[model samples]
Target: MADLESGEGKTPVIDIPEAVGVFDTFEDLQQAFYDLRMIGIHHSDISLLANEKVLKEKLGKAYWRASDLEDDPRAPRAHFVSEEATGELEGAIAGGFFFVGSYIAMAAMLTPASTLAASIAAIAIGGSPSAVIGILLARRVGKHHKDYYTNQIEHGGILLWVRLRDKEREEMAVKIMEGHSGRDVHVHSWSK
Candidate 1:
């Protein structure tokens, strides 16, 4: 147990080997559990699997209790997606394309399409700026809210958790989990 503290009043960065999925509601969490299972991703209830001593010592008693779901089976099981299966990364990249595509379509429609080359040129020109801005904006949002999301999970809003197979899988997992997640999805390396 190294010093988990990273900053004052911040959730100590525990060395965990899991990705936690945070959702706003219990239904969303449950749905994710079933959805992942459908795709053959083995998942387990974190509350049932977490080491009580490590949880209590690192995250505090409140989080420990929050992680526990044995007392109430009806309550959402804080799911931990295993290091298997896959998630969509194309969605994030496609979002950038879609955002830019809309403007390109509108511009092409409003202006005269005298030639296919002209239309193509308009799309290329318009799309470059829009795509850059869209991707940057998305990245900014993630950077700005990273802390807020981490705090939310610390305060017991974490609805699900997963241990990705690797970094690439983690990236994809974030996108997929974020799609279903109500609040946020975070990847952490938790020592067993």
Candidate 2:
């Protein structure tokens, strides 16, 4: 099927057929995302509703629902980050802290007056705060993501957009979304 869809009269040309859905919770949305991937949907082809700032700036709306953006090409998109990616980020953060502490400990050990025990103590002391700070920062990252979903839920439900080229893929997308308890799962004539 042609990626670019054209129809007569008042029908704006769309780049591709797109499926959209509203998920009541983040878990449902996440599950649909994974399932869509299993069916050969590219990661870049899936998008969540953009944040309030984007909605306001682009669509001039403080709030919107899945239906509102079903056919609108100007709707903004948000990137999806997998749980594994978030975990990796958290690990990187904590590991970075440890590396810094080790570096500092090594610097202290270079001093003529510093002994092995003192160096060890330096590592423990410096590392403790670094580790603590890192954990806190990582927690903040996790919380920020959680808050994003919560905020969206409060406004309505989580809106998901799946872009596809063919009718078969579009149907699969709609079914996958609906199976995950998606509300208003539908296909549009176009996508951004």
Instruction: Give me the candidate number with maximum lDDT.
Output: 2
lDDT of 2: 0.81
lDDT of each: 0.50, 0.81
Candidate 2 wrong stretches, greater than 4 Å = 1-14, 63-66
Q: How many residue pairs clash in each candidate?
A: 8, 0
Q: Tell me, by TM-score, which candidate is best.
A: 2
Per-residue lDDT tens digits for candidate 1, residues 1-192, read: 333333234332235455555565444655666665555555542322243344455545545433442222223322343212212233365476656676875678566544777776777777777677666665665543344334534656644555555576566556666777635456556522
Worst 10 residues of 1 by lDDT: 81-90
Which residue pairs in model 2 clash with each other? none
Worst 10 residues of 2 by lDDT: 1-10
